[model samples]
Target chain A: MKKHNFNSGPSILPQEVLQQASEAVLDFNGIGLSILEIGHRTSWFVEVINEARALVKELMQLGEDYDVLFLQGGATTQFMQVPLNLLDKDAAAAYCVNGIWGDKAVKEAKIFGNVNVVSSTKDKNHSYIQKDFSVPSDNVYLHYTSNNTVEGTQWHTTPNTNLPLIADMSSDIFSRPVDFSKHSLIYAGAQKNAGAAGVTIVVVKKDILGKTNRNISPIMDYRKHIEADALLNTPPVFAVYVSILTLRWIKKEGGLVEMEKRAKERADLLYSTLDSLPVFAPIVAKKDRSLMNATFTTHNKELENLFLEECKQQGMIGVKGHRSVGGLRVSMYNAMPISSVQALVDLMIDFNRRNG
Target chain B: MKKHNFNSGPSILPQEVLQQASEAVLDFNGIGLSILEIGHRTSWFVEVINEARALVKELMQLGEDYDVLFLQGGATTQFMQVPLNLLDKDAAAAYCVNGIWGDKAVKEAKIFGNVNVVSSTKDKNHSYIQKDFSVPSDNVYLHYTSNNTVEGTQWHTTPNTNLPLIADMSSDIFSRPVDFSKHSLIYAGAQKNAGAAGVTIVVVKKDILGKTNRNISPIMDYRKHIEADALLNTPPVFAVYVSILTLRWIKKEGGLVEMEKRAKERADLLYSTLDSLPVFAPIVAKKDRSLMNATFTTHNKELENLFLEECKQQGMIGVKGHRSVGGLRVSMYNAMPISSVQALVDLMIDFNRRNG
Candidate 1:
């Protein structure tokens, strides 16, 4: 049975990516050793990391002003490292608390320095994005999550601000195109759209670093990682290789322009189906709905369970919503084909016909 | 060609482990979703992490008194995190600088608290281990590297200390049996004997945590990781899965006792061959020579290059020494069969005949 993977992430990746990755695991680039066995410093791996870095730059249309780093500890680690490098005790950073991830970031930033919550959607359980919020001109930087994985909301437009911008694009990176020049730093855990689960991609404008008065640990410092070309220590070699393959796939499939086209189409199919069904309703406002994660809920618990059970029977996996926000979420990342969304729409339509 | 891998991690893994890991990447445990695409929070991955943790306990004969954490950052991250969680401003930690790794740890530890270098081999360029050094009874914990990957040294015996002991076992973990009770914490990057790059295995004695006066970052805090069952946030799922497969392979091959037997046999064969040859000289003292990484060199640079060229032509990989130590290093971790060592010995003998 073919499983339609809607896992929020370490989620769905392209079939070709998985195939190449598996083959590499056995014999990477015909090196005779598994990609798992090769040293990170080896020329083969150097090519991999370098190409992956280059692809990120190519996809984002990033100039030489930006530096790419593949670091460990995921976006969670970045939550702390970001402020540690940018915020000192005397400096205040502005945060847009639109979802759980943003809220968590705000909490971590407060430990490093003063964090001003310039905007928050906590009042409505993060069901919408803040379009009317103000960014403090005096703040060191403004931090925001470009897409909320759990709540299914995305910032379609980069927040216009004079201060530096730091965005966590964890769940939606590579799903669409972006104006790379607006942000000082953009980080994404590769488990989502980029590749596998071990590596995190951090793209920072090189000039934004080294200004902090706080003593950042060498491993935690962005400047140190950038200076070392992300090989300050032994990196996640295999993960980086897989990410390189993923970046290649993104480029091969006509880059972010095609990804954006597919994302919009997939989201349109699912969202339109849900909006049409009397039994189901979209979670976020239509204007703020995430193209990456299409979330919806049914008022009837029994009907919801039946629909989920039907989804499972039909080989639709991970459609169940995050426990925090409970009905269903279909994560349509960059690799999620329109066919998978069509299968879910078919399932939803069939279920609604019987239960409506 | 069936290449002989001698890379000092991310190094060779068992053939069966590689085959199994590769299969899992495509379809894990017959689940429709590729392992690369599955969510970390799913039952499949949860089981993998749990079993990997269990294998660590079973192999080490560790009781429930210890907690196992599969983290993201490599040993370098642990260098600072170890002290951040264990040390405070007023406290001091004792260190035994054996090699490059120990020097790095010392530098990182000094950032969090005062470090007392109770023993150092820098006096002799870390070519030997310290036998006469004493652990400071006043320090919070005594830290040391179990095996020096770059310098090719290992501590055959643990330093007896009244205070807590923390070890960075990056290169030698699982190469032999260990007395699990002797240490407060043990960390190893999984690129060596365990599996692949990305995941770090941290076994911390439960009683040793939450004693520090400093505020540990949430991601850096072992206590937080422990409470969350090492899933404090999204773990390196693919890396952890591969680690699980490697752990299973270790157990299937009769665990640590067989691994120790293989390690000793391979090291003895390679070291004996180099030691007997007039063209080659072992780098570290025989007493401190690492079973995992066997370092050797010749007085003549041309002869060394000729030997390396022959080795490479004969399908021996990763024999090149670390740049800091210009020579040859054959890292014979547990997965390296004695046959691989025999192949290297044969090549060295052939090279010596033509050059000697």
Candidate 2:
């Protein structure tokens, strides 16, 4: 079966990227050496790291003020690290808890310093991003998840915060261009829109560092990683390599502008199909809907099961929603082909007609 | 060119494992979906995690007493985590500082609690593991690195300690079977003997968790990970899957006993060849020589360069020594074929004949 993958993360990558990545695993850069076997400190591997960092900056339009770092651990580690490296033990960091990912960030930040949850839609069951949060003036920084893969909510616009804004853009980074100048730091786990898992890319404005007085471990210290150029230790070489491939793919496919256009189209098709279907109901408020993950549900459980079964039979994979939010979710990340969305829409329409 | 890879970590995997991993990235387990595209929470991926976990336990001959975990952030994260989860803020942890990795472990542990340097070979430039270390009586646990990839030192035998023993076998795990009952915890970054980068396999005694008074991040808490079956967050699915393939390869090639036998043969050939070469000198004490990484150097820089250049020309990759310890390092890891070591030996012999 020709599967159409809709996994939220550790998610789909470009076929070309997969092919190229696989070849590198066997023989990286025609060196007859598997990427897994290359010394990270070697000139060739260093070039791979440098090129990948450069591509991220180029794609994100980040300037010299921003230092792009490929660190180990995932966005979860950054949850604590951001606070550990930024917030003083006595100070507090403002967090907007819009969904599960945001909730996690807030939870992790609390471990290091005081966490002021400025706004939360947890009361609303995380149905949408809270747009009217009053930013705490005294807080170290404002933290928010760009897109909620589980709740299927996304911030349509940047939060108005004078503080250094830190965004966990794990689910929606690079899907569209944003003002990199507006935020002090942006982190994304590569499993989503980037390339692969294992690496967390943090683009930090260098000046934002060295404020926290806590004794941070070298691995957890953003300054240490930035100074070492993300080679403080042996990095996730293959993950970084694949990310570069994905970045190149993004560039070849016309960068974020084109990516945004395609993402909007895919989300529109899927949402419109859901809205039109009597059996299926879109979960999140349409205005705050995520361009990356589309969460929905059918009125009938049997029909929902049948729809998922039929979708799988029709070569659609990972359409099942998170257990926390038990429903169907189609994560149309940057690598997700629009045709895959169309196929899902067609299947939904047919299923609604047959079962309704 | 046929490259003979001897990288310390992010090291070479079996060619067949690489081939399988590459194919799976395009299409996993005949699911018609790329492995990279699958949701980790899905039953399909959950099975991969379980199987990988099960394989580790099986390989180690570990019973239910040990809980296997697949974690991110590598052993560096674990350095702090092990103390954060196990050590009370008032307690001390004993550390045997044999090499750079052991020193790093001690440094990271100091952040959480007092770290007692039980013994150290720093006086001798970490040339060998100090066999006469006294375990601190008041320490909560004793920590050591089983094999030093950089310093090229290996513990010929496990240190006797009354306290809970923790080993960072990052470079040597699964190369051979150790007495797991002797240690309360053993953690390894999966780039060397196991499989690839991004994932850290930690086998911890279940009872030792939740003793610390410190507020630990959920990701840093080993019990939380074990409770979640190592799916605390989205895992590096591709890395885990490749590790599973590598584990299967190890099993098919007759398990750890066979691996140890092959490792000994390869290391013996390389070490003996280095010893016989009048121009070159092996760095580590013969009794403490690493069965995984063979480090050597020459008195003459020109001769060293010539040997390295000749080896590179003859398809030996990653032979350059670590910059911190400048020389030549031939890391004959578990997946390294003995024939490759023979080829390396032959190259060294030919080079010596010309240079001598």
Cα lDDT listed for each candidate: 0.89, 0.87
- Model 1 collision count: 0
Worst 10 residues of 1 chain A by lDDT: A130-139
Candidate 2 off by > 4 Å: none
Report the C-alpha lDDT of model 1 over B1-356, residue by residue, as the tens digit: 66999889898898998998899888988877788888888888888889889989898899989999999889999998999999988899999999999999999998898999999999888999996777667789999999999999999998888899999998888878889789999999999999889989999999989888776678788999889888889999888888888888888898889899988888888889998988889999989999999888886898878888888888999888999878888898878888988988998887877787
Chain A TM-score per model, please list them: 0.99, 0.98
Off by over 4 Å in 1: none
The fraction of correct interface contacts reproduced by each prediction comes to 0.85, 0.70
TM-score of 1: 0.99
Best by lDDT: 1
* Tens-digit lDDT track of model 2 for B229-294: 788877888889989999999999999999999999998888888899887799999999999988
What TM-score, over all chains together, does every model reach?
0.99, 0.97
iRMSD, per candidate, in listed order: 0.9, 1.3
Candidate 2 A-chain TM-score: 0.98
What's the CA RMSD for each of the models?
1.0, 1.5
* Residue A5 displacement (Å), model 2: 1.6
